[model samples]
Target: MGLYDFTFYDLIHRNAVCYDGKPAWFEAETGATTDFSAFKTQVDCLAAGLQKAGIRSGDRIGVVGKNSLAFFTLYGAAAALGAIVVAVNWRLSENEVAFNLDDCTPKMVFADNEFGETITSLRDRLPSVDRFINLTDNGPLDAFDDLLDDAPFSGEPVSANDGLVIIHTAAVAGRPRGALLSHANLLCASLHLNHCFNLSPDDVHLNLLPLFHVAGLFMAVCAFHAGALNINMAKFDADKAVDLIAAHKASLLFDFSPILGSILDAGEKNGADISSLRAVMGLDTPETIERYRKTTGGCFYVMYGQTETSCLTTMGRYDDCPGSAGRAIPLGRVELVDDADNPVPPGQAGEITLQGPMVFKGYWNLDKDNDQTFRNGRHHTGDLGRFDEKGFLWYAGRKPEKELIKPGGENVYPAEVEKVILEHPAVSQTVVFGIPDPKWKEAIKAVCVCAPGQSVTAGELIEFVGQRIARYKKPQYVDFVESLPEKDGAIDREAVKQRYGGKQPGNS
Candidate 1:
């Protein structure tokens, strides 16, 4: 079958009966599993139920919850019936959550029982929502469980170009923006990814990343297309991860480096067998990649991309090379452009740009923002990168707007500073950013999360960093928070600024 001809819904339903009774999706904690046949039937029923409820194509349906077996089904059902799936970040504060819901204007919302209070609080503000379905047994709201009671109906013919999902990018350093994706875009991405990995039904994916993000959702869809089993988790818990890996014999797994660090520490301390694991994939800074290789001895694939371009534009194949994020996958055209949008020298740092079928249509309902993000049909990814002598892509850092400019006109990339901080014996995790100051235009600040039973003073850390890097680049201010916030694999810059931006000790 031609890759462009198939929709994501087609892949699951066609294999539903063929892979029926096979474990389609499994939850680690509860040991709950859903077979493909049952899942397909339920998805069809749910789609019909939504259709019967007057939901139609082009309508937005917001889904907010921790990872659950029902989450996948609900997402698929929404897409199959030609409705746009708007997956919300449940971890957001009540205000942030309300802001996004109001901005997106979804026709219906399916929220977890845990978020009932938050949803109820914003009920007065969300006049656009026609239905509110709850994920858990806590009543007073319509139960999502009742969705399965409708007639078993298959997906109707859908256009490849129709909108499928509106994934709102998390506000790691700025406000969240929703990227609209079409059925063709997601299907093409999944197909290319499946082929590149040589995915097979024998493969089992250990998924711990939140389902709301493109990283998690694309991985799940890619695994499904390959007829692979998916072992799902609500969040990344190191101990539970080890148990699930040992139990399921998961052959393929994907997670970010931070999560990987946790898994490695858990293994070293508590001890667990992960012999069945064939490959572990995600973002890996060069140092982290080497450390991961020494510890796991499993094939590691370092991937690089943003949600706006679907899951990935570049990734190195396992066992192909050590540090590259691989050549641009199949259909994608990857380019390195300077500030003026001119091609940079092979080794020179430039913004990584990509154009392909996998790129999203545009940010949902934000016309001016969409125009700015997409240029000449290429998605301008605001990441700095360069090509190696061997033609492997290496991520340098983020764009200047995203960087921390320190006092004395010194530029401090957080990733670079964090890398050096991570090298310190006592420091487990660190985030360095420029905090506003009066004496200096901006002062470098370090907020670190220490390893258990480990302690280091701010002065000691300042001295430690001074000995390693340039004096100007060393943090002038250091704060030890219980935990530095994070979203989408990066530091929570927005939260940090809001909490401790203005009126520092050196304020005017």
Candidate 2:
């Protein structure tokens, strides 16, 4: 059998039957919890609901909401029944949401009440979506609970290569591309975490990362697969996350570098005891990683992978080597390559390319992207990196087209924000880039050339963008220029960055 031989079908069923009373997932805000026994039934029932709704194998179902127990169940149930779960980033603007919905055109979409009006507003543009279920509460629309009340669905014939999840990527040209992850892709990544971290049922995991991204959905479920309790937060708050970690004595944590500070600050301020954490994973500096180890009494874990590769294709639990993303996992191989896909020497910088079961099948409905990305049977990660003398992989920068802004733990593509900024009548042309911020780690900055004789305030432009896209994608700092520097009749991005990207962004 190949490395991609297994699926979660057997593992989930085994865990459900073996660890029947074991806790599966919990939401700290509502104090809602579900055990494995209930989770099994809930997933089956949801699967039956999808079947009854006329959803067949290979059909796509959309979900747009915050982290919750129901969200995990929705994903699990769809995978069990051979339907692909399309996770919509709730932070996206209506138009951005429409583009994705219009792309995959799921048969039914499940959403929280917070987006009821937004979803209703998008109904006209989503021609393929026939049903909308209220995920949080019973409203005028169909309720999620109603789906669970249906007769349980029997397991389907499944394959490791079957599509299970569609995680959208903004890494390509500012447009959202759905990366179709197969069952093997998800399972391999989850199992890699389990194997490397020694995750077990006794572990309590605080899953604060957003589920719309792989970092949240894929990593948290590893704890679930191990029969561990996975605590979720609807929205991130340092105090709340810390309290939950302390109260539940969470053993594992996944968060961005900036968020870890917030959690530590809240914990320290409130005098909350978060000593139970034994493994905290994400980006952090040498000092911060040391602090995390000292504070949580856990090994600080760091790794690198994109939505296209599920999550962590590589990880290292180092007490010494500080900033490395670590070597590629046993189940995968990472190579630094030049433009023509030829491997560069260990010391030389090149594009990071991955070959493993963790790699997603390909982008949904994008043959060209899939072919290019899956060239030579390996997923080409657009990230630039290199291996140190000791073989530790280090991040460099992104490819020209794939520049990303990770503000407040969300991936913000500059082109996507620029697309919305150009939509404003007052704006003529703009170049968006990220700048280092103390709070968000990296905050967005937009350099603009306004229409002749037309005036626009920075606040107005920010508001204009905030309304049209995810608020995090809105530029934290905006600079209006009389005229933008040009190269080959296009805005010179480097010149724009040098001019406007250095200033510290105040809190927005």
Alpha-carbon RMSD to native, per candidate? 10.6, 2.4
**TM-score for predicted model 2 compared with the true structure:** 0.94
Task: Compare the candidates by TM-score and give the number of the best one.
Answer: 2
- TM-scores for the candidates: 0.78, 0.94
Q: What's the distance in Å from true for residue 326, model 1?
A: 2.6
Worst 10 residues of 1 by lDDT: 404-413
Please report, in order, the local distance difference test score of every candidate based on alpha carbons.
0.75, 0.82
Model 1: per-residue Cα lDDT over 64-147, one tens digit each: 788888788877787787788888777555665776787789888888877877787788888999888886656445887675
Off by over 4 Å in 1: 1-4, 154-156, 170-174, 285-288, 291-296, 318-321, 402-508
lDDT by residue for model 2 (208-273), tens? 888888888877878888889989888888899888988898888786778788788888999999
Backbone clash count, each prediction separately: 3, 0
